[model samples]
Target: MPSTIRRRVPNALLDGSRPTAPSHIDGSATRRMAIVLVTLLGLTHSNPAVAQIEGFTEPHATIDLAATENGVVASILVKEGETVSKGQLLATLDTDVLETTLEVARAQMHSTGKIDAAQADWRSWQSKLDKLRELRTKGHASQTELERAEADCAIAKARLEMAREDQAISALDYKRIEAQLERRRIRSPIDGIVLKVFKDAGEAILPTSPNVLTLVELDPLRARFSVPTPQAASLRPGSSVLVRFPETGRQAIGAVEFVSPVTDAKSGTVPVAVVLPNEHGKYRSGVRCVLEVPPPAGAGGSTSENSANRATAPQKTDGPPGPNRKDNHV
Candidate 1:
């Protein structure tokens, strides 16, 4: 008769190398033990579920709208939390001095009297030259008198050119002054919600100071996140992502817009960004979010089969091989 005995499992058994079977064990018990060991090994090799990545939502754009020209704020046309469209007037600087300068320039540019005077002088000189030539032809005027008259005509022509140059200079000054005046009035550069009004009426604003207003764009919001290197390698732009805002329980569909080519050496991860529609001002920027990305296709399947199929696949021809032979019969 056989007697039962127990012995300590050797480290070699745990290390996956086959161990010698106990001499007294029956075939049935040994098979059962082997089955249990295989199940444990299978569990160790299986992959874990990918964790959700953390992300943050941000405005499509943020602008600290500043004054292009420095002066006392004349008027504040918008308040914080106000929705404004692109090119909408937001604030104005003191334009009293600038407007006066612009008016002076305009007066100079519109002063046609100088140009008109130049033209009249040119015509008068041309007539006098003609008369001088005619007199010389008739032998009524001396050559010296004719030559002096011609010299006078040439001087008038030069004076006329000088006057025309003055007019052009005045016109350019007018445009420059008008542009300076326009810069005194600040306008929104994008369609967005005014986050803050830094300066109010009667306050001085400088180009070097903090911006006059803070603006944020809400439409087409952006979400920024990072993923593990292995997963990021398989991701492509335009891939769909599911986003969840844990704090608000809000959800939105997003599409991958950017994937960083380089991985972070320290963290062993890669950065990515997605764009989501935020029409109707529903989503707010600067909110924390969670992202769920789908796993790649054939994730656990054979790579060799996929590669073979791709290598042996028939390539598309540029045109139909000769026309259909059936058509030739027709």
Candidate 2:
């Protein structure tokens, strides 16, 4: 059975603890002391823990974008390890030949414009012939003169149609040549630190085999790691991933933007690519990392949790941590 007790004490002493004064210290002293202790206890219990994951300091990646339409490398604007921003012009190919081709095409297009005007003139002549024929039928013009006018109009009309076709062909050629010239300027595919320069100035670059001068798109990049097949089943593309960059003292979240259809037979691991934003530009393409590609968590845990408790269980982080590997995925 439960029991309760109550007693009274002096009004002034009531607010103090330790059985204060004259045996008349009021019971209010005990009450105030109890309230103070409870406030302290609540404050202590309200603090939340900050969670951190162990991961590699630097993200690793490789330099490997192939050449664009090429010619002799005219100039190399950057060296290996130089930083480049997205669309920064890193190298110039000797696009002189392409430039000449484009100029020639433009000239041809201009010539076609003249031919186009001549064709329009021929159509005008044809209209005059039709008017003459109508006038002859009304006896307002001679047959001989009307016949000659018709013949001249037919010839002009034929020449005009031929000129128009030529003009159209020339316009198309000009655009195609212009596109080739534009492709000669090689720009960085992504804002990345230049890790390698495969081409030097004056190197003979070929359209069939391009000479890539600068390789980039590294910073704040893709981290490629593999997950066990069973663990991978729930990971869909574009799913959010928790990312940690230890080197930069950065921690953030990203999305699972890629996963391999092919699985490794020996390791049973499937490749996954995650796109994590690197605003600070601190990550590299090939650095290995330990990625906590998040949940649906505990994906490979015991099957017993699969049925009931797994759906609602809170994360139990006490499990042993895994190795930190550099992610070199480009």
Please name the candidate that would achieve the greatest TM-score relative to the true structure: 1
Model 2 lDDT, full chain set: 0.54
**How many residue pairs clash in each candidate at the backbone level?**
0, 25
Q: Which stretches in model 2 have alpha-carbon errors above 4 Å? A: 1-65, 68-70, 111-145, 206-209, 226-250, 257-273, 292-330
Question: Cα miss at 272, model 2 (Å)?
Answer: 4.5
TM-score of 2: 0.56
Which regions of candidate 1 fall more than 4 Å away from where they truly are? 1-51, 207-210, 300-330
Encode model 2's per-residue lDDT on 43-156: one tens digit a residue: 212211111122332333445655565467788888787877777888787777778888888888878566767778887888889899899989999999898998888888
How far out, in Å, is residue 221 in model 2?
A: 2.7
TM-score of 1: 0.72
Q: Which ten residues in a row have the lowest lDDT in candidate 1?
A: 311-320
Lowest summed lDDT over 10 consecutive residues: which window, candidate 2?
312-321
After the best TM-score superposition of candidate 2, give how far the Cα of residue 218 lies from its true spot, in angstroms.
2.8
| 280: Cα error in model 1, Å | 1.5
Model 1 C-alpha lDDT per residue in residues 210-301, reported as the tens digit of each score: 47989998877888887777667666787545455768655554567899999888777788888766666666788777665433444533
